[model samples]
Target: MNTNRTPNPPRGDGHAHGFLGERAELVSALLALTVYLTGLILELTGNGGPATLPLFVAAYVFGGFFTLREALLTVRRGRFQVDFLMLIAAAGAAAIGKWEEGAVLLVLFSLGHALEGYAMGRARRSIEALGELAPRSALVLRAATPVEVPVEELVVGDTVLVRPHTRVPADGFVASGTGSLDQSAITGESIPVDKQPVADRAAALADPAAVDAGSRVFAGTVNGAGALDVVVTRLARDNTLARVVRMVQEAEERTSPTQRFTDRFQKVFVPGVLALVAVLLGIGALTGEPFADTFYRAMAVLVAASPCALAIATPAAVLSAVGRAARGGVLVKGGAPLEEFGRLRTIAFDKTGTLTEGRPRLTEAEAADGVGPQELLRTALAVQRLSDHPLAQAVVRDAPALLGAAPARSAEPAAVNLRAVIGRGVTAELDGEEVHIGSLAYADSLAGPPVPAALRERTRQLAESGRTTMLVRRGERYLGTLGLMDAPRPDAADTVAELRGLGVTRMVMLSGDDQRVADEVGRAVGMDEVRGGLMPQDKVTEVARLRAAERTAMIGDGVNDAPAMAGATVGVAMGAAGSAVALETADIALMSDDLRRLPFITGLSRRAGRIIRQNLWLSLGIVAVLVPATVMGMGIGPAVLVHEGSTLIVVANALRLLRYPDVREARARR
Candidate 1:
């Protein structure tokens, strides 16, 4: 049960405000520019003494205010930051009686800072948008009537009435009635899913989303034309929408490899710049240069050495790419995973629920010589009703059509005694006759002659076709075998092909199913390697082996897969919209069950990594070129222009990541 409602604040903290909040720095920069222009006109006209000096002074004050605060903060913390260097440069210009030049430098520097803040704000907007999706209040049913309440007040097992076109206020299962839902907030699907009654517990266990009208409804999704009575399954704080918001907020704060590298570089780089400036000043003074000229040249060094662009290079691109990924239905948990995912050399996928849909369906059935297929199905369905195993539900689903009516519990024969053997099968006395259904080993242990060799061969054939087979028996006779298949996702092959196209060096399928079944699924999905009959820990061992050789990513969705997923370099949870555990444990969560997004995410991450490298080089290249020029006698004003211009260019380069198109279109272009 969850208790909290509001998600933690996102990295940027989007708040409603007048233009001041969004553009304070921009406004200040504009004012400084205006004052500088006025001072220039007065100085050029030569009546500049009283009017021009005050205008330049005012311009410096307006523009330097923001920079001064940052510089002061850095100084108080005993740190050398780019802002401190800019402050020293501005003061050096004024000390040399170049007040107008100082004012222009401050104006450009402040403008660049303002623009960077605005660009970062755009990146943070993606997480903030999620905060606005779920409604704050919902109508709850009480005493056979409806009453409105804060979403936080709603608890598990409560019934909530959702009117047409209203956003669902909590995570729950549809209890009654039916409706289509705009589930984009959860699954990122553009179309609505039609709600129907859910199946029994076994079916639901096989695939949590398979329940009929009991289809899971997530908070924040809009209800369609018909009314839906949803039974609250999770409290307000535990809803899928809330978790999405929380994860996004958390992800933004984690540093990427590039960001960490930049931080390390700056620690040495900032102090080194200060030392270089000091050396220049000492050498100029000792060489008998005029104090004004010496100090002016040192100030130029300060302006040229500030690494504003270098400082923001990685964060700008990283933030933009993370936000873009979220909008495309993939939640990259943090900068670490995003960077790691881009370096994937191999991707290991789980078979059931990943490469294939989790739901099993009956594919083939054979009967003993005397019994028809329908009679065998009826007995299997009746026996399965007492259990909810995935294979049992598959048989139950097929029995209704054969029986020409829904299977009724009352119609099932009363069993005098019942027993279920885990991992083997079940035994029961129905209509005073002994009955058994389970794996062939279990059937062989019962009071029956050996199963026909032809029947055994048929079951093996089904397994080769990627199906699970069960043996059925009645009294002393062998009934037959039922083959169940959990088919691969429609897009599984395409996803594999696209990943290979995206430079995925290897693809492996790891499954708990039989080896032959795993091989069939691997072949169908074009997997490069296949390993089967793995227990949960075996999967983890395989993931570890792959990671030891090269970077590896494991994609899975189940409680058992959690450990294996956690062991991989990057863990991707498929169909995360339906599983809370997947949402919490996965390094990356795919909101939709769509496998196609895997390739898309790979491409997006690779593109982001490339852009970060580009930004770093561009920023460093600018410093490399401009610093030497400034030391060789470039003027303070021109150095300021080049330095601040490079800052803007770095920001512009990072903003290109925000143009990340739809995943499908991106893949198509690739």
Candidate 2:
């Protein structure tokens, strides 16, 4: 290892630009500006003549250092870029004894590049901040002894001690201890999530619905109150932060349509401009125009028509918007997705986790004719309290609220002689009678192989409606049936409504869930279409059908959602903190399960597209005016100033996105 110096903090790309590469541009720009101002002031004040020649030459060297290097590198690679055009233009102006005009061109060119670099650097700060959030050293357990080691040295299967109030060392399951974790760093969850040991990796992976705060903890999230022994499931380099950064790096290479167009335009436009400048010079010679003046006009025209502003128009806005989205806990993969997201009028949602709360909740409670509602609920809660099944737990939670005609807190039911049948149901003694609370099958075996006709019908209706049914019986007499369902999230309906208000023409829900369950959720969320009982491939087929007609985005949160996500115009993964597959596969990742981020980012994308168009038109208009004006006797200095000024304006316009409003801020204003 090179021990001479400490490495800079890792950015999204895992490396930073070298000092001379970054500092040379900024420092050179500043130095060039200083020298140019000095010479111009001297000439303007009438205290300068031939004495300012050396100053202008020094200014040119300071400003053109990086530009010259870039020109040479591109030439060596058998290509010409904007830098080559810039270098040639400056040289031509100097050749005609117009050193001041040439200095202005080079100074502005370098300064514009420095500002562009700054914008790009700011765009990367969000991801870099996340990478930097992880601890530098992990307290590893070797032979049960705590040893501090660099996080990079950590490997899979290593155990790390996560002390209370400190950030987690790596992505892993909680092997021991109980506490709450502040996952705001990774998931944007403001509330601290209670956590407990969950060492079964396979079960957690197979059932991500069971993977909650207690099951999987990500690196960078703060541990709360209690210490935890975490088993490292991923290497430091392959943690969630690293994966997000790697994908962002990959996405950067896939630019927007406008950027691609400008790039192609430059390749042909540069050579064509060079040829046209030659024609203009030839025409001037034939007309007996002064040779020095003709060459100067050609150089001015080259600088004016460089198209630098047009080239940066799309990327600046895209990068700024992407960075802004990142700050709001939405990671847009690239320019393509950002632009596509803006134009999206249709989105497909997965039912089980995407639209619903993703966990069991009580939906219905029907008491028998003889039993009071409170008695039925109290007895059911008493029996279910002894069971750990998800449906039972949901009933135990929901029953207390319904004990009254007008739901409010009340007395607890006392149950004794509790017996829990694993993965099935629970039985207990309540009010001196044997009471059972479990699945219909389990209840039938104990209460009635043929229960009350009305009760059975109610149970059947609940099951057919996509609810998990739990029957309550006391002494072979059916008391009531409780319906458990994964209810729609509180924000789901609002999110769909906001999308509609944003001009979304279609809203679809595609799920692997039963047709009834999917339809129920779709109706609850006001979706335009509902396709249920879909396997992963079926979801992909639906997304493809949507793609054939209009731009569609697929939103989901599982390995199953990955393929459909890839099949759509843009794939978005909700609640990505706990799922590596979703994070890697989706084009956009919402760190939290906030449906509101959907509308916020969509609006952001549209705003970015608008700014990109504005920048493009402004840059193109300036170029159109300058090229003709320069050829028709406008001086080199003003032509260079106007051209560079437009590039600055484009960058500034794009920079506005860096301060774009998030949903909360937008709501507050309203």
Candidate 3:
């Protein structure tokens, strides 16, 4: 439901543009390699001299095209870069009459850049493919006749006809049909979900995207066997897929803390390597060693010390992990949260809708001694159905089927002259008798300061067990009591157990529900702490307190949870499919709404961290070994081999995350 308005990506041709740029770089690198090899063959076969020198020069020109371009631009900006250092080393090799070695260096460097670009393109393509999941054109209903139009032309209120086997064109509601949807692409749901028309006119009016989750459908899901008339609630650019793509793009642009540290390291590392190379040349001249051998050794040291592998290590791993998470329906906002997720040890949950199913169910219904149970139930339904309160919805759904229908002698019963008594209950007239349905206190405040001992006892028992009970009265006579409970989610306990397994031992539930009900749910979910009966501001205070003690994460899916989420180190939103507030506010959004994804994302973050540390050490370790060996006696050819070889090895290691398995599966393997 996130509707943050980023400019929509261009339709139809964006992926092609990205593909072509990578292909061009690769072709240039291959051409340089071919030239360098041909020059080598001529020299070894005794066809070498001044005449053949031009061939090696051409090889250097082709090989250094991208490196020289970037190096020149970086120099103009008064900045030092790895590319600039490589260009200087290659030119130094040529000045020392080692033209073949200079050509070899440029060819390998350009080819490494090309091969890495091709590897990184896989991550970029995964994001670009998301924009194309929904069809380009939608069969929009135009005055009862279906006409195909570009998806971008779709606006709110347009009725789109989704035919079987086609992708849904925009996020909308089922206005006139029922069917099943394959939402595996959007929600990672393994089974096709049964969908039907669900009407909530008021919710759709206030925020079309905030409608009930069961009733909503998103773009890019494959339709099942029935035709559906979907009323578009969001514009094309504000759909679920669009928001995900925008967030991923933003994530790649933002640097992580590790990337920032590496950047600072490189600023000093690049300049210092250049100064060391210069000092080596000056010493060789002072000692009167052979100029060619000393100069060649100094150039080799510069190539080895350039920090090429170090520069790409962290970013490569971060990008691969971000792309992998997006494919599994987890949207990480940026690299900062990706890193923070792995380090979180204290996670707080909001109860009402988060830990539980969010829907209240009727568990018990009873009547007084003189009251007919059917009569009591019918009368209660008439009064409760008209109530515009949040708690009344579930009872209204449960009551109609149990009572069947009104008698032939009377019209459909409805409460007239209705008035809500705010927090206490509701008051209205049913067939001219004053009827009320409210808490036990509200009933006691009326009907003689108390109902009956039996009714009070039942109410007390239900409340003690964490079930909410309401009393019904008809003027001066008491009717009956109704008990309801918001049960905990089936997977809540297992998810908490897995989180504990992942090293997050402190799991707390912060709820606005009654203390007793919250405690029951917290225990059911296997949480270590329970803080219930908290207001929105109180939840924020608790989150701030938790943050003071440890790195905290707050997870919820409502507008009220926003403040507490902002206070925590990381704010995670569950079921963010259609809520703009959830999407914009939470640092990470589980697009699928499955609690299992929580552990998956956390595991993925931890795995990415391990890979990043490995990369940094491997790259730094190579630079450590190569710089000293080249200074002592290593030749230019061997130095270039080991240095570029380490760069390739680091890139290959980071790409392993693109295939990281689910946490449960990984544990099974181990």
Candidate 4:
């Protein structure tokens, strides 16, 4: 929740100053307790009168200063904070010659505040831990010599020398190196990812723009066992780690619905409490009770009715959950999304990247009558070699393995006059003959014979099975057709099933791919519906439709899906570590590309929502029982004990979420 208190700046692992510091409040509480105990001991020894009174006075002042200051500040702002009620209760106890009880009240209240601060500090440690991962300085390579420099001084296009076991200095493409890197800080991945040099023309022919294993490294990932010469692609402050830290900090500042409700409740409830105390004092004076007794009873009413537990209920739980979720690689933008995620009834996912590997793989190839398989393979490779599309890469990758030999990379006459038929296919002259390689319609567009019934039937079979068909032709003869499939992720089916297990009643796949391809992928992943061939705006319309019916979340990681994701009840960006826009645009960003994080985050949100409710009810339940009991004459000491005890209970319950088990770990156990 947004508090009047400005958030402390991003801290390192070291302790902060002031009352929020872990050690400061704790030391204050201990000092006050020590003085309080000394006062009790003096009274028991029958040497109490002036000496014990001084000790109690010292105890109250030391233990209650921060709370008293907060109470006064809140009063100056014309509001009644929970501390205001505690301050009044303690003052009334002191006025009634109950210095021992008032001292105890201050000490316990300060101790609770100390413990709560420590707990919240622990929660904020996740973001603080991120700050510690980046090194203050890095080795920059200037003019073929390595010179150590502050990270902030390194600019884009500057080369950096990253040594073995050192953190990557910046986000960049490797100039020369091959090694594994521990990316847990950015992606929450447990295993080290092996990276290779950026693709030369040959490798690009096989897999274009590959992310991992393609020399692209991010800042804060530890380089392993090998050195790298990296060309800095981003400034230090604009690195992936910096953006993650910033997003997390911004997310925590937002207020949840429950927190707002409590804030509003306090605005009314605090003044209501003051009026109730006034009525109690009025009735007691009318009934002829002594002024001291009447004042003591009103103080009891203040302590019993104060909403300390309620005031803290939502923030504690949200901060705890958001922190732990960040550690688990799920970035919840705020308590609003955290609460909305818990209520998500339907989840719409993009087909590629979200459910599938997002790249095509060659699966089947057929040669025409009287055409040998090797000849057909070589011919297809010769035509596809001139293109850079995903299907072309799929063909290029499998050609060598399938043929047991590489295509002839001759100096001349193998293929020439290559041309691209944008989104349709590629054409080239092979061995002094015109050749066409692409979809059936593109082949028809060329100066070629019509496709035979047999070839047409084969294309239909591949399309029906959700595979893209690439037809190869030599002059007027149908050469062959290759089937390419963008395979579903290994975890896709399990993720879909688990999401349903977690009460996601409706799951759909929205894709810009062919209808058959989309439907086949949805069936494999166990989705209830599949909508394919959608333009970007179409996805937005579908998401809006779903949101109008029920709470919906759109999970995507592409430019096309951004609008739709923005239109949903919650936008979940998968593999956000690779995309800065995803991190910024999504309400919930999963650092890793893994689909399983979805169910995990949803489950965690559900647990957080339940905890918030439990805390609220528990807080109000204590008030409902204690307020009337205090009015009916329960002593202030016991009432204070119960009131402060309930506040601690609510905080402790929220802290339990910090230890909530990870979904991946649970799956690993199974």
What does each candidate score in C-alpha RMSD?
A: 4.5, 5.3, 4.7, 3.9
For each candidate in turn, the TM-score is 0.88, 0.85, 0.89, 0.92
lDDT of 2 by residue, 259-342 (tens): 778778878988998998999999999999999999998998888888878877887788678767766667788888999889
Off by over 4 Å in 2: 1-20, 44-49, 143-145, 175-180, 190-192, 197-211, 224-228, 373-476, 665-670
The model with the greatest TM-score is: 4
When 2 and 3 are scored with TM-score, the better candidate is 3
Better of 3 and 4 by TM-score: 4
TM-score for candidate 1, please give it: 0.88
lDDT of 4 at 668: 56
Each model's C-alpha lDDT? 0.80, 0.79, 0.81, 0.82
Task: For model 4, name the residue pairs that clash.
Answer: none
Sorting all predicted structures by TM-score, with the top scorer first, yields 4, 3, 1, 2
| Candidate 3 C-alpha error for residue 166, in Å | 0.6
lDDT of 4 by residue, 1-670 (tens): 1121225221111223233465776888788889999999989999788899889998898788767766776677677778888888888889899888789888887777777667666677755677678888999978888899999999977878889999997877777888899887777666788887765534532442244534678888999999888777778888878887777777767888888798899889989999999998899889999988898889888988988889888888997888778777788888899999998889999888889988898888888777787778888887777777778888888777887845356632367788887888887898778888889888777764788888889988998999999888888788788888898999899988888888999998999999999988888889999999998999999999999999999999945589999999999998887677888889999988878778779889999999999999999999999999988889777887787788889889998888888757555546
lDDT for 649 in candidate 1 is 80
lDDT by residue (562-586, candidate 1, tens digit) is 9999999999998888777788889
* Lowest lDDT block of 10, candidate 3: 7-16
Expressed as tens digits, the lDDT of each residue in 1-670 for candidate 3 is 2222212111111111246656876787788888788878877898866656787788788888877877776677677888888888899999988888898888888788777767767766776677779889999989899999999999998989999888999998887688999886777665677888767544664577556666689999999998888889888988988888788878876777888888889889888998898899899999999989888988999999988888888878888898888877788887788888888899999997788888897767788878877877787778877875656876777776666674542466777887887788888898788988889888877745368899899888889888888898887788888888998888889999988888897999998888998888888889999998899999999999999999999999846798999999999998887777778888888887677788889888988899889999999999999999999988777887888888888889989988977755345346
**Where in model 4 is the C-alpha error above 4 Å?**
1-20, 44-47, 200-213, 404-413, 422-424, 443-450, 665-670
